[model samples]
Target: MTPPVPAADAPADRRRELRADCSACAGLCCVLPAFAASADFAIDKPAGRACVHLTPDAHCGIHADLRQRGFPGCTVFDCFGAGQRLVQVAAVERPVADPGVAAAFPVLRQLHELLWYLTEAAGLPLPAPLRAEVADLTGRTEALAAGGPAALAAVDAAAVRAGAGELLGRVSAAARPGGRDRRDADLVGAVLRGADLRRHGLRGAYLIGADLRGADLRGADLLGADLRGADLRGADLTGALFLTRPQVAAARGDGATRLPAALERPAHWGAAAPVRTRRPRRPGGRGGAAGR
Candidate 1:
């Protein structure tokens, strides 16, 4: 049976910074990224090519009606400045060039992903040691942002990741709930093997590394929640609402697991039941491609 998606459980105070402040950016994400066919993306797009729906000024052409037009994936992507940083400093000469112009685009993508995680870290509670680490990394990342493309390309990604990882480990440890606190709390890594957490308010909670091997999370609210590293080996998330596909991709589930209707099981978790498939034919056939 198809399970219902959980309602959002994220708190109002826990709002993510959309960084719309980045509007001044040259629309690097719109011009330099690639996407394949998936639940989130309805069509394929080549790198550096402006999404067919992207406007001359780099705004989404369908900005006023994305969901109505079946382009929800655009809503979930977060660039974290990788696109802008690359374009401004790395390829300053290119004017809205193709996605392939920046050799460091891939590297920038990784850094931006890291930045996403670190940005979330800025909000979590942390110990003094971890907090200190977060401050240092945040400062360094900010400095790197101010540094031009050459400096960004010269960044040691591994070292930055290590520092972020250390701080994240601490944040996860500190954020974990204990004993009955686990009864209705967000357990990022609580070692619960068979807990029942159904119909609870888990909005915006962290479930990373939680041992939900046999837990029951059916009918739970999971809006805007982060479930990375969560183990859903034999757990039930059936009928959980508002659990987006990208959120599902971030978790680890197994064959015995149950998922919400709108999401597909992560490949690492096992082959999920196929929901839909189409012939290799493009959406519009060979004549011409559809707009983004």
Candidate 2:
């Protein structure tokens, strides 16, 4: 039997930085963003309007059955804990119907996404010099996030993203030396099942709807890779660098898929069998007859 590989564990601060805390949030994602009728959404909603599925208590009415209710897009969308922070910044206790708050959502979302990447970069095993640089970047971004709505809205988001992207690019290069430079490659609908992509640099690659089943992706850098609708069933992503929860959520996978430790298996991935232990089974055991 293969030894169980430990899932990637993020530092607590970084984990909190990346994961959504909906209870503390004001249902900003449901109210602030617009949606159009598509495969991902069942109806069209204008910005500043609460989603039809949003309940009175700021919970998703179909939270447990989002995918079954034609809202897989909601399942895949993550604000990296930005929604709550935006609510706090705006001083609102619950979902606000104000247009200004709605307008600031996109900007704050981008800033928080930057914070997510920078926070992740800080936790990487980079050289001391690079680590210090990452820390500085993270601090600057956090300061910007702490600024209220007006300051956040005033930010040049595009310029900030570009600057942070450069630093993250260096971090990716240092982490995965000699990896393939496949950034922004258009591989949509490409059939790459069972390909050996170990240690490849796939940053910003457009892999929409790509068939990656059973592929070997060990140690590959997947930063900013567009994995939406990509088939990752049974793919070995052990040691994959820069793979985020949002990226994994956007892709389709199965129980056999191997993922890094930091990400949870998407619920859409069918139920996985419980891991077996080394203990021998007792006589007439529920699992088997005396370890047959």
Top candidate, metric lDDT: 2
Q: Encode model 1's per-residue lDDT on 81-169: one tens digit a residue.
A: 45555656655433365434344555555565655555555554455556567657767766665565555557776687667655654
Which ten-residue region of model 2 has the weakest summed lDDT? 1-10
Give the per-residue lDDT digits (tens) of candidate 2, residues 247-281. 99889999888887667888889875454456677
The residue ranges of model 2 lying beyond 4 angstroms of the native Cα positions read 1-10, 273-292
* Global fold similarity of model 2 (TM-score): 0.87
- Relative to the true structure, candidate 2 has a C-alpha RMSD (angstroms) of 6.7
TM-score of each model, in listed order? 0.50, 0.87
How much lDDT does each candidate structure score?
Answer: 0.59, 0.82
**What are the candidates' C-alpha RMSDs?**
16.6, 6.7
